[model samples]
Target: MKDKKSAKLNLQHKQHQNGHLSPSTFAKLLDLEASWDKDQLGDVLHWIRQIVALICGLLWGAVPLVGGIWLVAFLLISSGIVYGYYAIILKVDEEEFGGHGSLLQEGLFASVTLFLLAWTLVYSLAHF
Candidate 1:
C-alpha cells in the first residue's frame, strides 16, 4: 500500500512537472503551502480580489442589487476573502506586508473600479 501511494505521488509530480496536472493535483497546487515573496504574495492577493470583484459584480447585477447595501456587501466579501487567505490559509505575517491595512488595501481601488464597471454594464444590459 505504501509503495503504491508513493508511486502515485511520484506519477502526479511527474505529471505536474510536465505541465499536465489533473484537477485534484491542480487544486493541491493552489493550497498555498509554498514560500512566496512579498511582491508575489501581493500580486496574488490583487488578482484574487479582482476576480472576486468581477464575480460579485456579476451576481449583484443579476440579482438587481442596488443602493449602499450591495457596495457594503462587496467590500465585506472582498476584504474577508483576502483576510482569510493570508491570515488563515497562508498564515503569513501581517507585519511583513506592512500590516493588515496595507495588505487589505492591495488592489482595492482597482477592484472597486472593475466591480463598478461590471455592475453598471450588467445591470444596464439586463434591466434597462
Candidate 2:
C-alpha cells in the first residue's frame, strides 16, 4: 500500500510537470506584471511594432513598383500584425497601450521610417 501511494504521488507530480502552466503560477505572474507602469508597457509594444513595420516595409519594398503603391500594403500588413499580437495574443487592453491614437501613430511612424530606410537602400543599390 505504501509503495502504491508513493508511486501514485510521483505520477501526479510528473503529470503536473508535463502539463500546462499551473493556474496559480500564471496568476501570480500576471499579478506581478500588473504592477508595472502602463507607459512602459506601451513603449515596449510601440518599439516592437515599429520593428515589425520596418521589416514589412523592407519586404514590400523589395517588390518592384512604379509608384508608392507598396506603402498601402505595408501599412495594412504591419498594423495588422502588431494589433493582432497585442490585442489577441497578449490580451492587452487599449487603455494600457495608450489608446487607438497612439497605436495608429506608432504604426504610421514605423511605416514611414521603414519606407525611408528601404528607399535609401534601394536607391543606393541601384545607383552604385
Point to the candidate with the largest lDDT.
Answer: 1
User: Which runs of model 1 end up more than 4 angstroms from their true locations?
Assistant: 1-32
Each model's lDDT = 0.84, 0.59
C-alpha RMSD in Å of predicted model 2 compared with the true structure:
11.8
Candidate 2 lDDT tens digits, 59-86: 5545444356666766676677667655
Task: List the pairs of residues colliding in candidate 1.
Answer: none
Candidate 2 global TM-score? 0.56
- lDDT by residue for model 1 over 65-113, one digit each (tens)? 9998899899999999999988998888899889999999988999999
Top TM-score prediction, candidate number? 1
Model 1 alpha-carbon miss at residue 59, Å: 0.8
Model 1 RMSD in Å is: 8.4
Quote the positional error of residue 120 for candidate 1 in Å.
Answer: 0.7
TM-score of 1: 0.75
The stretch of ten residues in a row with the least summed lDDT in candidate 2 is 28-37
Clash counts for all predictions = 0, 0
